[model samples]
Target: MSLAWNASTDNVGVTGYGVYRGGTLVTTVTGTSFTDTGLSAGTAYTYTVRARDAAGNQSANSNQITATTSGGGGDTTAPSVPGNLRSTGVSSSSVSLAWNASTDNVGVTGYGVYRGGTLVTTVTGTSFTDTGLSAGTAYTYTVRARDAAGNQSANSNQITATTTTGGGGGGKKVLGYFVQWGVYQRAYHVKNIDTSGSAAKLTHINYAFGNVQNGQCTIGDSNADYDRFYSAAESVDGVADTWDAGALRGNFNQLRKLKQKYPNLKVLFSFGGWTWSGGFGQAAANPAAFAESCYRLVEDPRWADVFDGIDIDWEYPNACGLTCDTSGPASFRNLMSALRARFGSGNLVTAAITADGTSGGKIDAADYGGAAQYLDWYNVMTYDYFGAWAAQGPTAPHSPLTSYTGIPQAGFHSDQAIQKLKSKGVPASKLLLGIGFYGRGWTGVTQSAPGGTATGPAPGTFEQGIEDYKVLKTRCPATGTIAGTAYAHCGNQWWSYDTPSTIGGKMGYSKDQGLGGAFFWELSGDTTNGELITAMRNGLG
Candidate 1:
């Protein structure tokens, strides 16, 4: 049973809450909620809560609540075998599977998922996502049905899945962007990746916004990168940093700890997002020098072990972003060639390129196809095609997977971007579809559907028109789905974002296109439990 109560205040500030069961002290927690397990079946219990302070002063018990656990029964008949078991998706660290339902004399209760003949987990559904496996490895799987009586059926047909190679080569890659500024305002830390259960499902992490200035790579925030200290509670390994001379601290130290925990997971330093692409022209002017500087910085002894390679996020080479660039079509290829030559074949080299599929648009403004030869794969930024940046109405999904009727612009959708890149001679295997973890919306709208006129951008936590999935999942609640994505409208507000269901569909499309895998805009926008990334892992399996 789970119990929760309103918080109480103290003169010196409340420290923690104490939970009680039937007039007896149970356990205490720092949060407002607690879950009690190992209770008797079909038995009722009463609970109460009290607040405590640092001085050990306790407040009066609050109102009491009663709850009961579900009863369990016994039967002997076993369930029939689950039929037609098969692998649905495979990634660097996990495998997704599905099977037909089984029949039982007293009704089937659950299905047991097995890896290498060992029972891994029991689930009520027909599908399961098995994670924490090694990269570039092969494993076999099977399933069996269980009944209310605890009777299990025979194992279903066995199947095998091989995880992607190291560094996300030649297979599906589940990469997520971790922003440096997230620790300040968002309160998202490297520890959240482990607590939210995202570390085991990820193949790679892109540390965003490594600066590009004066034709050389630079740290975006030295304080956030390696100076800020973390306490024991804030550390990923539960060991605080010491203030000793030359001790590594902040996100860099935390990332090192995370890498120690997840050996197969790779980290890449990403440079030149929308706000910093202006320096690309200077870097392009001296490609060899720029590559040399980047190699030196990435290989700096202070934190050289934290990264596997480097990812270029130049918004749009030879085109427009916050500031337009006329560095010519060959600049992108030249820069990538220099990086490859300097980094050698041991380190991975990748880039995030424009998904503008429009003829003579951003895609045509650079030589992405010519540059593909020097890279392992490309993170196709397929999102942010439209949003409230247009402000006054004409609501549309920011990350539509396919073009739908009445779309604001032709060739702006994901499929169009993918086909255009392929037509430009870019290999499908080197393309990774992008999914946004947030949404874009508009307010003062009467119609709840797309194409409705709006007054302006909708209210959001940080920015007007943009919100995270954790907020939108409950705030607006998706009223409908369109163009392979989801949208919601509550009162005058209209928002569009991807739910787990929609991400599954997108992953299916990625597999159909023979693409590398899926990646998202960021990790902070996800729920506390990491719902979006979980869906991405399961969908790609």
Candidate 2:
């Protein structure tokens, strides 16, 4: 038979290629490419080709080729790491990135790009474009090169990029509450009130009720509760809490103290929460009296000069809250109109409304959109949408962005509430996103992640199913994002809450949606160092 060699260089003429089995030379073939027959199936073989001359001289062996006659091929070498990763273009909605080519021992196949720990795209080329991102969003990206054998290289150095802030300047602003529930004042309650650190990164502080009189609404008293409350109140305004003492004389003095302590801070008096909602109906019944009562309560001659504004937390005006109110929607408008008429534009006027986005729950309860015209901002209580009230099933998301498959509730997400308010003609710039200081979770969840249902809300130390952000961030770090929100899970226990990373994303969403800003439930729930609040401040910036 004629002998041949595959591109072999030698002094000898091409003769044949040697096929080896178990390190032993088996047969010699004339053709450069030989199909060895009569070989056992699924056996390993090592082959090397050599050139032989007509004079019977054999040359040294060529490169060795090892093959496992099995069902599939195997690759032992990994692809190269992608290089020169750089952002090509950036915008509010998209970012384009490019990288240098990667080489593998066998061959390079493709590259994968990750944004903020998410696998954004896989491309066969060196560049990939990621879109559908929120404006003003900060993204960290990494690239990996893959080979045909499915071998992947280690990720390249991460590249951080941020989207544009956009041209439309108006966005939402959140007004957080500073509920001084008589804890920070008394040395005993001071133990309960954790001021071991500085104040949280909050835009506004609505100091809880300034009322101190035992029955007559007087300010200063020797009683412990009365004394602590009065002193605390007075410290904020730099004057004694003198009740029945005109606006500027009493509360205004406290305002001055607070202003002096936090020069950049804005102080607003929250009229009625759950405890004080009873008087709202009567106040709503008579708009002038309601306005006058608030005017006197807020603008008391003792310290009227110090207060910058008033915040009405009526719980629910037309709808039942801590107490039921028969007054209709128009009554809320009347009360707000009176307040606006009395306080005028120079003073800030805002309200904390229910998070219920249902037509009847919030819209029918009061003409909130109509009242918006009379106020500078409206705080949408975007939490407490779900709890242990419903029948036992999946532990629902307290603040969902949109409806998704298998979602227990149809319209209970934060996005739905905001959209509902906007549909009612409220401007996005005046709407503040409400974030809960705590997380609601359920125990006995068999699934590993957020969408799974729990037997019921899990038990908590202080409260059932609700834990502060400080605890949850350490207990359950959010790992996934759904509809722009973040959630996490641990064996049989699932928690849905926001982290700094998630908050950053939400801040981008707020900027993209033209919303004002963010507002958390309260300051005390945050960590002593105010880590979460710092994230909010930096994320907003």
Candidate 3:
């Protein structure tokens, strides 16, 4: 078929055209245009089409049309350089790098990541993780955008990031679990942690509270009566009196001493637990008074230097805890806003929340997503899905990684809890995975590992409940793996606890999901050598 030009712009009424390549005429046609076939692959050909009239007069060629045949479409443009590069506050052996999305003319398909002038990875993502680098070493990175046509854009501005010093060998994310004091004293149950090895792996040691009592801070010695109100109720089925100021100062002084010993540790006073959560509704009602009381309690001149931040552990507001508070969800956001304004940005504010992944759980608790904007991180209490309370025919997994064939609760697993929070717009980096140092079990079991049943609640030392993970790891080992978690049965007792192998699996999941890190209930429950903690740290690597 003869090629026809749409229109002729030259001085000649084009009758025919000559197609020339590299100073040689490739074809001549009677029509205004000609098509040249049989072009070699990957070969560059410069062509000019000259129009000739019926008088044999020719016109200068239109702008030269230089085309290159392709073996395949090769990308010539490098990726757009990454922008808004930032470094994390506490660096470890390896550093995380993230940037804004790159742009391309043909639609960006992926990215070529470079570290210190060397290509590290070609990721189809805006972020790339660089591992195996020396701690405290500085790294310079540049990213380029790749289009569908395989062409890449020029490199964007180079951004530099530095790794932190003194991580435990490999590029593991080090998360130090700060045990809330008094929950586990220096006893074998939750106390004996190996301080020597902990220093190298730990990034922060969080001391539970500075104020005593389950909830209230006794103003004076008269408050001694309220010291163990909740624990007393558990023992003596009676309601305890409020704040007897007598023992308040002594407990504060004791906290001061503990802080003196661990200077590098961060002491955070956590207010509100299961029993003491009643006052939060009232406190949350009056944001100004609550903020004032918190400031005075945490910032007391005597222990001002001792505390680094304040953690709000309101068990459940507007929902049921040991008691229920009707202070609507907005109350939580208001309280946190006042606290953030009063405490300013320097102090850290965090909260412990239930892992109930249902709509009721979200409404029962205050505005967690709203509060997230004010707080640094939201710690999801992922454990305690199944416990002695569910004393029944079919046994349940306490801290299941995923939903199994017969999970006790429909979406009560750790994975569900985390995903629920993420779906609410809470960044993964700001969410801390909760790990229980204790295990929940039942007596009169039948099935073997991970899938056994008990007729009643398992007996504990002080309470007829759960035992620490340290004890269960040795006492009862799992026979089978359940959703990357473990459970076992020995004799008439069924136990569930995370082993090093299972922990390793969970850690991989956490990293793949881009989570911040893991935190356990109390430190004292770990082995003297900190074996479980080490497993968590190493697994994070």
Query: What would the TM-scores of all predictions be?
Result: 0.69, 0.60, 0.60
Rank ordering of all candidates by lDDT, starting from the highest: 1, 2, 3
Give the root-mean-square deviation of each candidate in angstroms. Answer: 18.5, 19.9, 20.0
Clashes of each: 3, 36, 27
Model 3 lDDT tens row, 1-541: 1133443444534445676777677655543444444345567878777777647888777666677766755545544655665432224445555566777655776666777766565655454456556777788988776666556666768878776566432223444444333333443211123243554455545545333242234232222212433332222122232355543332333334444554554556666666567777777667877887788877877557656677777778778778777888798889889888888898987777878875457533667766779887777788888887878536766888766545666677886677656555566667777777777889988877444556888887555658877677777767555656777787888877777777776776566555677767767566667777787888877
**Cα lDDT for residue 29, model 2?**
43
Badly placed stretches (over 4 Å) of model 3 are 1-196, 209-264, 363-365, 449-452
TM-score of 1: 0.69
If ranked by TM-score, best first, what sequence of candidates would result? 1, 2, 3
Model number with the top TM-score? 1
How big is the positional error of residue 96 in model 3, measured in Å on the Cα after superposition?
18
Predictions in order: lDDT: 0.85, 0.63, 0.63
After superposition, the stretches of candidate 2 with alpha carbons farther than 4 Å from their true spots are 1-168, 172-174, 182-200, 209-226, 229-258, 451-455
